[model samples]
Target: MYISYKPLWHTLIERNMRKEDLRLAAGLTTNMIANMGKGKHISMETLTKICETLNCDISDVIELERE
Candidate 1:
């Protein structure tokens, strides 16, 4: 199965936050953001940082790919 961050993208839009804003707010590197954009894997530590910054649960940002 794959993971999708479409929820996270929608949440960012709802929050009026740019990807750059999330990067800075979450203390993430550009490479990390790029990875997320490409639906690539990142560490849970990075995921936790994003969740904390957005005040959201992991499920709010990620979902399993229906295959």
Candidate 2:
């Protein structure tokens, strides 16, 4: 299985937040956002930051998916 950021995109939409906004609020680099866009693996620390900034749980940001 692979990790998917699909839930993150939905959460962003529900919050009316742009990727740039999330990057700034979460103190994330542009490259990190880019990697997420590509569904690439990111560190748990990064996920923690995102969850904290968005006031969401990890499952709200990512999910395991079958290949």
Candidate 3:
């Protein structure tokens, strides 16, 4: 299975927030944000922070792709 963060990007767009805004609001590092941009797996803790900051759920930010 593959993971994608496309949903998160869309969500951010819907909220009129930029990637840097998410980073600051969620207290995330540049590396972490970069990782998400590359569709890399991040820690559940990080996921929780993002979800909390965005007022969203894990499902809202990420999806799995079956291969």
Candidate 4:
């Protein structure tokens, strides 16, 4: 199975937040945001910070899918 982040992309748009904005709000570095854009694996701690900053659940940011 493969995880996809299109839903999270949509959510970000709906929230009217740009990638850079998210990075700033989440206190993440540009490199971290870049990695997320590439769908690279991230630490749970980082994910938690993102969720808290965005007031969202993990499911609202990421998904698991069948390859």
Could you say which candidate leads in TM-score? 2
Q: Which stretches of candidate 4 lie over 4 Å from their true place?
A: none
TM-score, candidate 2, is 0.98
Residue-by-residue lDDT tens digits, candidate 1, 1-67: 8999999999999999999999999999999999999999989999899999999999989999976
C-alpha root-mean-square deviation, each candidate: 0.7, 0.4, 0.7, 1.0
Candidate 1 regions exceeding 4 Å error are none
Arranged by TM-score, best first: 2, 1, 3, 4
* Candidate 3's TM-score: 0.95
Per-residue alpha-carbon lDDT of candidate 3 for residues 16-46, written as tens digits (9 for 90 to 100): 9999999999999999999999888999999
Residue 20 shift from truth in candidate 4, angstroms: 0.4
In order of appearance, the predictions have TM-scores of 0.95, 0.98, 0.95, 0.90
The lDDT of each candidate is 0.94, 0.98, 0.94, 0.85
In model 1, how many backbone clashes occur?
A: 0
Candidate 4 colliding pairs? none
Q: Give the per-residue lDDT of model 2 (tens digit) for 1-67.
A: 9999999999999999999999999999999999999999999999999999999999999999999
